[model samples]
Target: MHIPGFDTTTIGVADGIELTTAMGGTGSPVVLLHGFPQTHLMWRHVAPILAERHTVICPDLRGYGASSKPPATGPDTYAKRTMAADITALADVLGLGRFALVGHDRGAHVAFRAGLDFPDRIDRLGILDIVPTLDTWNVLHGVDAAVAFHLYLMAQPPGLPERMIAASADEFFGHFLDIWSASPAAIPPDVRAEYLRACRDAVPSIVADYRATATVDIDHDRADLAAGRRLTMPVTVLQQDWGSALGFDAAAVWRPWAPDLHHSLTRAGHFMAEEAPADTAAAILDLLDR
Candidate 1:
């Protein structure tokens, strides 16, 4: 079922992939992107409130949710650049030449890239519960081993990760909702089930998306770093204190990419938007206003 008062659409993006997007409210435009193992419903709480004042667009990113899932042809196919273009085209379809952008997990990676690549398109940016992908991978170690197993697991060659995850998609994806959230009720029973179902149904496309990160995505990010490119607009990053868990300052790590940055830690778990919707919505509105 659709979120209350929101309408859904399946629009074809540039790369032969179609996205199932949830849209609501009216006024200035804002696009909210979802992360892994979850669909656009992750924004159910925050989007409506933001929709009160802005046009809120929530899309199941390329591989996840009800969106189209093309074969993984090559590494570049699922690159954030391609994914970022999908968002831009979605915004254009909605007649939003400039829109505020918010993303979490995998979606946040796309948002950060969108901000860098299309500075004029994403007027303001907010990333929840994640740092840059390369930054996280760079700081990995023995202590972080357990916490980051999914990254390693998904980053492996296509055959193994796909078969392993497909074998027990529910158990695998449900584990994140259980462990990553500070509270079980943070993701209601129905929503949790929906996430599991979607993940199970989209194993190949999903794994391909993750595998792209280990290869093509890293190359793009490294090239950007080499050029010293930084986000030109205001940026906000709200994350769980992985610093203590992973041993690096999350905010400090984000500063170089986003010079005009507002970064902070939250009491909520990795799914901050759901566990702390009021706070997450407030942070996002704050970013747009800045």
Candidate 2:
């Protein structure tokens, strides 16, 4: 599952946590974070393209893929604040004073937190297919919320969610891989198998990651919102047109957090980096230029 030109290694980013990272190219650094139910391999297509112009570092988020899966000892354990810190620590460990960051899905939450929490260290920010954490909760309601059933499932109490998901890990994780992509061919069979295998082995940590979003992550976002904290760097958001179907203006939702924003809609599925790597990489490169 390694990207052809990338070198993979384990780098310790926190106490007892080491991230499995793939790094390639030799220029300004850009770290790409993967979303739910997938690993750094999710960026296989897009990373190579970006690597041509920047040092592309793709890591398996702590709880997913080949990274450390510490038990969720407390709500803070998997909070986006904590997860975001891991990225900064990783950069620090790699001697990067500042770098551009781009994230998709759950990783987008982490990237958003990083942009807010460590503005000086982030040169530019790119978020794929997600609204801000607070905005996400604010926008989903009534029947429209049903589209995000997995959010509720994982947001439940610890034991129940862990047990429920573990009982049918593949089916649970595979559901997103199946339904979220408009172009199934984008994820070949081998890649799909790898994603499922990773998710299957990391159900508890994955659920813990999501559970933190419902609790501590929200608290952090609300505090930031109250403080009027915004990403100080240039930000680009590429998303499928879910706002129209779900009854909200996507650009409007992102504008407050990202004052210097470039928001565009993609015809590709939620997995835009895979389904539309050239377009995704182009947007990321454009963000770097800004």
Candidate 3:
């Protein structure tokens, strides 16, 4: 399920966790990080377009896909901060002194952290369909939080989430693939199957990744917020109109963290890169131009 015309390789980042990455193009680098239950393959349609003008690196976050999945030995192992460091190390290994970064869903959380932790290395930041981790927890309330039931499910202490998800992996993963996409045809049969298979096999690591959001990741975000740390790079956020329904001003939520922010709502589903590639590519190009 590699992106066509892209070369795939496994590069050791940090914590001895090697990431399986698909890379293409030949100019300034732009790294794309995939979300949960999916891999670098999500960028298949969007990457080629960005590749025309910039080198695009798409990687499966450490816990998912072909990437090395070390057991969550500690609270920080799967934290977004740890995942963010992997991107910095990867850029160092690839000789990219600085690079633009974009991510969707869970990956967007990592990108947000990277922009804060490595402002010098992350030239630009693009986020798709997510708010910051702290804000996410803050915004969800009462029945509305049910929209993200999985977050609460995975946030629980280890054994239960791993067991529950693994027991019905396909059904669990496939549920998001089905419900989140407004245009079902965007994810053809093959790609969807690949996502499910990847998720099914990586349940423990995936759960750990999510669990961190509820623990160490929040602490990190709180520290940054308290320190008045903000993303110094140009930031672009594209989202489905979930904020309107969920009762939060999406742009307002992002503005404090990203002073230089361009936020827009998309017609596409949560998987904007796959559902609306051309538009997604355009947004990345626009972000780069900023």
Candidate 4:
């Protein structure tokens, strides 16, 4: 289905990975990445608004939505570096040598790695509502652990989380879609169904994605920490002030990783794109200007 706001196209890259992309308008290329349990359609509200002024390219990251979901090639194939490689490959396939990158949740994890691995190609980076992989793993315990049950659950020995989640896909995904935001009415019924369907279809890949976090991703982050490699581009972060819950200075933590950081406490929950697209789009546009 065509995501409401933008024109859609498909690009066939290596390994026969056919990526579904929503492209529109023109100027400097701005690549938008969506979080987990969602698709490129997550940017439906924001992309076309930016598309009027920039070339907005929003693609379904591998194993999500209409994107190719090849069988896992081992633990390594699901790593953030491998996923980031697909983004670079997409840019190459489209002849975009340089572009701005924005990603949220799972996509943000890939974006951070992409910025570090291909700093020369990315002009600016916007990571929505996430910290570095190592930081997240290092920080979670007790109540914080409870909030992130998916992390530990998916890291288990396969098939289990996928089967359990597939049982009541709507309830599993829709629970967050309803509670994560300050407003419940933000996402309409059809959009909510689409998100749930995507989540159901991508369950295995999603499990593999989170599992990589506990293994290969941690190694990568620890290596970067050891090397003192911080983000070189100007960075903007939008997150809920989890001080009342997670009990840490969210912005202060990001400072060491992002030299120039723009941190804001948004009213929405995890699905900030759908919950607060106006604010989300505005934040993205503000970063684009910066």
Candidate 5:
């Protein structure tokens, strides 16, 4: 379970928020961000190898894991733009000028925005198992809508999600861990416990993150499309064939956003990085090398 050579520390990255990071290795910097129903530990299998050559940095996105999650004032608090700013601050504190970034799930949500907002700082990006937030909302219907029930559930008015999740936090969080992985053993027992613990304590902040995506985050994406602000950096998107499920050309959907994109359909489940670490790490290295 130990990530060789990596050390953990918490750093203040945004207004009243502190991010917990696991960083090591000594070459070109590579930041790895975790997604929903998980923590920075989601990268447990992939980070050590990446640390062999690159300075792999993994952080618990605010509101998850050990990060400090302050009260959300408005939609902006959980907006990817705000979350991306936190990453910029973390880089500043770590003395990194520019770096390659890899994100999975909700973390990918932030990475996509970071690539768009801080093009100069994020040199290249690798996104696993997600398209843009706008694309997600645009494609929801019938069975696909059922596939993403959590999206609609958490996106509802703040009070409802916060209360419902808090009432059965461990059960709610553990559901994703059990259902999303291709194999039940992909997430070991201890790691699964940690995810449940974190989500149980931070229900409000976690749900706010989802709500912001439905509101302000979508607005930002739509505005970017209108303004034609595409992700200009080298991008690699490794994902399940969601196009088949959602009935949209995933490549065609990403092409407009990523001018230079290497898109591949991964043969793993929703939790691809953990389910297929070797393949995911190779894809990440290829993204950075590109």
Candidate 6:
């Protein structure tokens, strides 16, 4: 129940959005973004550790956890570009002109979009357990499709996915809490309840977030590819060994987009932040130094 690094503070990031954030220590800024089915609490172990020397700002991404759930105006608002805009706006509100960015799962998708959108603002980027939108769609075929079922499921038409997810929110969101985590024992009852509640509340925005993936994300990636735009900043990627089992080298796939890429395959599952914070933190520091 007690998250290791607890520092609750609210910040008005955007219109009608007051994000619940956890700030620790004080120094250069390092914004930590949480994945799905979790919150700023997911960074409990990693944030404070980084906060030992840096000002760590971990926020519950828009429509997730304690953050305000604004109505999804359309695909534009829920686009990862818009979500990334929220983060940068939060940084500006907090007086962070530029900073390092680290994100896991859904957050990582946003971070990748942010890096492409605001290359100057992000000094270093660490994307945990994910590939780019174009890569994700291009790679999925047979068994690979099974690993990323949520991408397909959430990409459905308007009210269908939302209705289904809302029907059994806890069971829907808690699936990852139990499976993606190597040490499911680490996430106790209360934390799991909180995660479920957050997911339940943000279902619309969360669905919009993924739904944008099928549209705006594709357009964004195509534009970037055509423009020959790649992340100039150093990038560290840590993910499971899905490539070997699926018959593709994940790193080989990443090298084209990121010239300075450090890819590592971990024993942990998708939720590496909780399962292997030490390694995640190490990879983050390594990226920052570059």
Clashing pairs in 2: none
Candidate 3 yields a Cα-based lDDT of: 0.93
* Consecutive 10-residue window with the lowest summed lDDT within model 1: 136-145
Cα deviation of 137 in candidate 2 (Å)?
Answer: 0.8
lDDT of 1 by residue, 123-237 (tens): 8999987777778778788856788798889899879999998888899998888899896888988888888999899999888888888888888888899999889989999
* Candidate 4 minimal-lDDT segment of 10 residues: 178-187
Candidate 1 residue spans exceeding 4 A from truth: none
Per-model TM-score versus the true fold:
0.98, 0.99, 0.99, 0.95, 0.97, 0.95
lDDT for model 4 comes to: 0.85
Residue 130 error, candidate 4, Å: 1.0
Q: Scored by CA lDDT, what does every candidate get?
A: 0.88, 0.93, 0.93, 0.85, 0.89, 0.85
Q: lDDT tens digits, residues 98-170, model 4?
A: 8999999999999999998889888889989888898897678786678788788888877888888778777
Q: 2 or 6, which is superior by TM-score?
A: 2
Error of 5 at 227 (Å): 0.6
Q: Alpha-carbon error at 266 in model 6, in Å?
A: 1.1
Please give the TM-score that candidate 1 achieves against the real structure. Answer: 0.98
Positional deviation of 279 in candidate 2, in angstroms? Answer: 0.5
lDDT string for model 5 (1-290, tens) is 34557899889886678998998887999999999898888888899888889998898898788898878888898899999999989999999999998899999999999999999999999998888999988878886688788898999987988888889888888988888878888888987888898889889889999999899999999999999999989999999997887888888889999999999998889888788999999999898788
Tens-digit lDDT track for model 2 on 23-116? 9998999999999878999899889888888999999998999999999999998999999999999999999999999999999999999999
Is 1 or 4 the stronger prediction by TM-score?
1
Worst lDDT 10-window in candidate 2: 164-173
RMSD of each: 1.0, 0.6, 0.7, 1.5, 1.1, 1.5
